[model samples]
Target: MLRLPTFQLHEPASLKEACALFAEHGAAAKILAGGTDLLPNLKHEIYDVDHVISLAKLPGITGFEMQGHDLVIGALTPLAQVATNPNIQKHAPALAQAASLVAGPQHRQMGTLGGNVMLDTRCQWINQSYFWREALGFCLKKDGTVCHVVEGGKKCVAAASNDTAPALMTLGASLTFVSATGTREIPIEDLWVADGINNKSARPGEILTEIRLPLRDHTHHGAYGKLRERGSIDFPLLGCAVRIDLDDADCVRDAAVSLVALQARPLLIKGVDALLQGLKLGSTELDQAIEAVAQLAHKKCKPLDNIPGDKDYRRRMVPVYVRRTLRAALDGTGPVHHI
Candidate 1:
């Protein structure tokens, strides 16, 4: 039954208390929000801990307001709220679409937007427990020093499993982080680091308090596409999010494209901006842009053999998803609408 080891559970009423608890417990303390990922890992003894600090009692951050043209989403907001929020759908369609595709209804109800964004990802070899890992001689994400997904590699090979990161990037979002020391904000791209062990830039005592999304005008269009093994309840093998803003004359003003599950963090293709320059995102133009985006992403990402999909298949589908998602965005077909 993979029973979790006994541990002290601390429920803090405020962010201050949560930070203090984390500091007190140090590396021995684990933070708990939606137990969607942490609980299973605990049950398998992936990492031993003495304390579980709960962030449930803390008041959930909500309310979408305009700071000039920017929209702010509270970090503690639930996935269900983000998925169904009409304000989000109207302002940032790509983000709303990604929120809707995260897991199923039950998970959406219990899981939170902050938890989803902060969640640590997995590789096929790294997700197994101590016994399975011991048999495999361990991986860099766990106890081993070498990357099992890539033989003789020194770095961990866990994939970026977040559903929201790519979408938020397309919307030009930034994250607000609060810690025992102070508070600061940085672009979403900056929050993720290159190393899997520290993929998140948040310190041990830090908390992600908010996500700031730049509001899209009526001229802007965006979409999100997820490729998974099942109809639902499976994490993405490959995913893409794209946003484009056009002038009144239908000329491209700006473009953002991000791909997920390909590496330790979401891969942003800045080349899309150059490819989309001064042209409308029609089928022909989008095709060329997708090719450019795919090539850039392929160069940046080195997908491991650990996950389910073939490397060649994932590589081929990068352009496919890029083309399809961009087309859907241009057509104003929201993720929910396409489903």
Candidate 2:
């Protein structure tokens, strides 16, 4: 049986207390919202923490609300709540869809949105237990100096495993962070640093307070697609999220596409915004757009030896998923549930 290494547990009643605990513990401490990820890593001995700080009792952190044009999602909001919330479904269907696809019903019930956002993803070389890692002499993401996934590489090549990040990113999302220092807001896309070990720019003492999603205008439509080993329990091998705006005549006014599980950070397809601007969605235009996105994906993605699917197969599916998601959103087909 997998057993976690011994550690002291601390429960903070308020957000301030939580930040203070984090400041005190620093790298020796690991923040615990939902134990879905952290607990498993601990059991595998991948991380040995001196203390586990819990945020179960944080006040003023209840649910989601819309303030002006932003749909504010409280950090404590559970995955199930976000997935089934009527407001989220209506305002940010892509995010809702992504949340719904995470784990099973029981995991959804326990996992918080903040937990999902902060979930640590893995590569084949680094995901193993201590014994396995010892045999392999460790990988760059875990302990070794060189990345096993990328030959002679300095940076960790582990892929970004969060499902919601791509969905939120495509729709122009931002995050609210609270820390002992102060509070600040930044674009969700900017939160991720390309480096694998320290992927997030969030400070050790900062708590991810809320995620702010822009209210969807009637003219805009969006969708998300996840390609995993199965319909359940598996993390994504590749995924796509797309949002686009159409004019009265159904001509495209703007477009944003984000693909995840391909690299250390979600890759945004550039020139797509410019290419789709003022263009009408039709079979011909869509075909051309798909071709263009395919070129972009091919050029942008450098799939490594990680995850379940073959790198070549996963790489080829990027444009397929991207096109399907964009087409569905443009046609108003329906929500593409990750499950």
Candidate 3:
């Protein structure tokens, strides 16, 4: 039975208090949201923290509602609530689907939307018992100098395992963060960086507060697809999220495709809107457009041999999953494949 290290726990009654505590403790403190991810890492001794700041008591960070034309979701909102909320289902079905597909019912009940969004990068070698990793001399993501997946590699290549990030990115979401200094907002895409060791762009002492999504029009449609080793309790091997806006004639006016678990960060395939602009669904050009998007994804994605399944095989499936998700988004149907 793995045991967590000794630490001082702080229960902050409000966001301001939490920020103050974090500012005082600095890097020695770790934020505790759902504990689904952080607790396991603590037990495994993957990282050490002298202070554990709990956000359970923080106000204004536990629910969702519409603020004028945008949907404002508190960072501490539970994944289960996000998955089942009527507003999320109607306006951002891809986000709802992604949240629902995270881990299982119990995890969804405990995991927060912010926790899922801030999920750490994962690799097969590093996600093991302390003794197991100690025997292997550790990896760069933890306390080691070298990355086991890449010989003599200078940087970690752990894959991004978050589900909702891609979905939110597809919907043009922005994140609000607070710190001791002040608060700032940026597009969700800006929250990620490509490096695995230090993936998120959030600064020290910053707390992710909320997610804001733009209002969706009737012509907007979106879908999410994930490939995992199991139907539940498994991180995605490859995840795809797609959104398309269509005109009266069903021609695609704009499109976006975001993929996760393909790299160290969720990637928004570039030039998708340009490639898909003015293309009508069910037209001969549709297949070509899909293929073009798939090719672009293939170019951007460079999965390392750090996780389950053959790296080459996973790369090959990117196009397959992207194509399926795009079709589902356009047809207003769930993605055909989930494996």
Candidate 4:
């Protein structure tokens, strides 16, 4: 059995106390939420930490409710709760699907929304036992300079494997973060950075507190599609989330497409709305628009051979998955078929 290294545990009673502890410990401190991801990494000796700050005792960060015109989800809300929340299912079914599809039932019960959103970039070489990584001479994400995935690469190429980020991005979500110094809100897309070694843009001292989703109208629809190696307990090899708004005449007024597990950070496909706007859903022009969006997705998503599934096959699936997700969203069908 793998053993966790020695570390000081801090159970802060409040968010303020938690922020203070993080500020006091600085780089040596690591935040512990659901522990579904962090504990496994700790057992692998992926990174050493002198302090483990638990957020369990902090109140007001573990519920889901509607506030005015927005859906406010506390960051610490469990994935299971997020998946089953009636309001979320009604207003943002794509997020519900993403949350429900994460790992397995037990993991979904234990993993928090915050934990899922802040999931670390994953690579086949690095997400292994300590001995396993040591035998391969390590990678840039952990200790050594060289990246196993790329020849003489200057940066790590681990892929972002979060299931909910793309879904949340499609829903126009924003995050609220708090720290000892102050608090700020940023669009969900801004929460991710392009660097695999440090993929999240959250500062060292800030703690993500809540995720806010804008109000949706009757014409709005969304869908989430994920391709994984198995039916359950597997991270996504490629995931696509799409949201589109249709006018009275079935013409697309707005559309957004976001993809995960394709690169170091989840990407919002650029110019999707421009290509989709004013296009009727059932017209031949719609077929051309779909082709255009698929082509764009294929061009932008370049998967590396650092994770599960064939790199080339995963790349090829990008357009196929995007097309399927778009169809599901526009047709009011359920989640896209998983491959």
Q: Which candidate is the best by lDDT?
A: 4
State TM-scores per candidate: 0.93, 0.95, 0.97, 0.98
192-260 in candidate 3: lDDT tens per residue? 998888689998999999999998978898989988888898888898999999898989999999999
Best of the candidates, TM-score: 4
Off by over 4 Å in 2: 334-339
Q: Rate the local accuracy (lDDT) of all candidates.
A: 0.80, 0.80, 0.89, 0.91
Which stretches in model 3 have alpha-carbon errors above 4 Å?
Answer: 335-339
* Backbone atom clashes (below 3 Å) for every candidate: 0, 0, 0, 0
Superposition TM-score, candidate 2 onto the true structure: 0.95
The residue-by-residue lDDT of candidate 2 on 57-133, one tens digit each, is 77777598889988899987989999999888777777887888877788888888988878786787777788889
Candidate with the larger TM-score of 3 and 4 = 4
CA error at residue 124 for candidate 3, angstroms: 1.0
Q: In candidate 1, what are the lDDT values of residues 271-298, reduced to their tens digit? A: 7888776886565765676677667766
Candidate 4 per-residue lDDT, tens place, 231-255, comes to 8899999989999989999899999
Tell me how far the alpha carbon of residue 305 in candidate 3 is from the true structure, in angstroms, after superposition.
Answer: 1.0
Error of 2 at 247 (Å): 2.1
Worst 10 residues of 3 by lDDT: 330-339
Order of candidate numbers by TM-score, starting with the best: 4, 3, 2, 1
